[model samples]
Target: MSRGAGTAVGVLLILTGLVWAGQGLGLIGGSFMTGQTRWLVIGLAVASVGAALLAFVRRRGG
Candidate 1:
């Protein structure tokens, strides 16, 4: 991926990390779940987004 796309992944990772940490601490709602369900749902969602971004991001011309 281009450097900019890599940077985008890095930012996404940060956002994903923060969401998980917040979920662990009960600082934010997990949209469609409660308690442990929150962790599962949010984690899966974040992972899916990351994977999709990685798959579609421009891979040449950094």
Candidate 2:
């Protein structure tokens, strides 16, 4: 993907992960994932991947 597209996807992933994490932690409610440990773990993993993608893009001068 293009640098711009990658950046956008990374940011979106980070935001989505944060929301999922919040839901998992019961900080943002009304979802089936609320208070779910599995969701929390998944969210953290996704956020980490997003962060890694952002870092890689930046490092590559993209």
Candidate 3:
């Protein structure tokens, strides 16, 4: 994907992951994910991937 597209997707992934993590951790309750450690771990992994994508794009100078 183009740099701009990649960046946008990466940011979106990060935001979504944060929300999921919050929900999973009961920090932002009101859903089935609340207090779910599994979701929290999954969200963290997704966020890390997003971060890695951003870093890769930047490193590639694209």
The RMSD of every model to the true structure, in order and in angstroms, is 5.1, 0.8, 0.7
Model 2 lDDT tens row, 1-62: 77888898889888889988888888989989999978888888888889988888888875
Sorting all predicted structures by TM-score, with the top scorer first, yields 3, 2, 1
List runs of model 1 lying over 4 Å from the truth: 31-62
Evaluate all candidate structures by whole-model CA lDDT and list the values in order. 0.62, 0.87, 0.89
Task: Give the clash count for each candidate.
Answer: 0, 0, 0
Q: List the residue pairs that clash in candidate 2.
A: none
Model 2 misplaced stretches (Cα beyond 4 Å): none
Each model's TM-score, in the order given? 0.47, 0.93, 0.93
The candidate maximizing lDDT is 3
User: Least accurate stretch of 10 residues (summed lDDT) in model 1?
Assistant: 31-40
Residue 51, candidate 3: alpha-carbon lDDT: 94
Predicted candidate 2: what Cα RMSD to the true structure? 0.8
Quality of model 1 by C-alpha lDDT: 0.62
- Residue-level lDDT of model 3, residues 1-62, one tens digit each, is 88998898889889989988998899998899999998899889889889998998788877
Q: Between candidates 1 and 3, which one is better according to TM-score? A: 3
